[model samples]
Target: SSVMVELVGQMKDNLLLDFGEAKKIIKEVVNVFDHKFFINRKYLKQEDDSHFQIQFEGPKGMFELQVPKNTTYLLEGEATVENLSSEIIKLLAPKMPSNVEAVGVYIYEGYNKGSHIISNISR
Candidate 1:
């Protein structure tokens, strides 16, 4: 049976200013959820043009998700950290197959917590 994933945002945007920093955070977030969620890193693949890639392996098989880097958005508004993991989860949940056994989400831990929240996926 597939499990449903839900994320309740608890913090404000502390968006990373550097692209490298942002990509690093996303990678860590993925590692966090890989275990119980059966999200194997070996199977994960990032987009050639962007770092925001979401990959998952389940009983039903593999799924990939990514949002093209919006340079225009970054240039217009100062890059502020957003709960990207939450955003991805919300976008992905409804589209996920019902047989997905686990759910994972990454939440920003506010500026005081760290540069970014540790990589994580929920089950």
Candidate 2:
């Protein structure tokens, strides 16, 4: 009877150890999966050779983002933008003065070559 009691105690400890290790492995796997989804483009776009190629590259301001003509980006979906560099402000200030308040985002796009640029200003 005493032997059986000791055996049960040992089995409980073994189960606890196994469960702890399993939990640790699961947590690590979950973290890796999240990183791939969130910051990395691992699953964001369709997998193609073009997908792997660079799309847009520029300094943080006055960027020319290619978009389908007349497409609108939702106000809620705006991505983060840092303080506009002085170079960017110099180009913009001449057009829209005073009203270009701090912490505002202005999105502008041109359709065809030499077409008038339509801008959406948000604050």
The best candidate in terms of lDDT: 1
Which lDDT value does model 2 have at 43? Answer: 18
How many pairs of residues collide in each model? 12, 0
On TM-score, the leading prediction is 1
lDDT of 1 at 89: 50
Candidate 1: C-alpha RMSD to true structure equals 18.0
Query: What's model 1's TM-score?
Result: 0.23
Which TM-score value belongs to model 2? 0.20
Question: Which 10 consecutive residues of model 1 have the lowest summed lDDT?
Answer: 71-80
User: When superposed on Cα atoms, how far off is each prediction in RMSD?
Assistant: 18.0, 25.2
Q: C-alpha displacement of 55 in model 1, angstroms?
A: 35
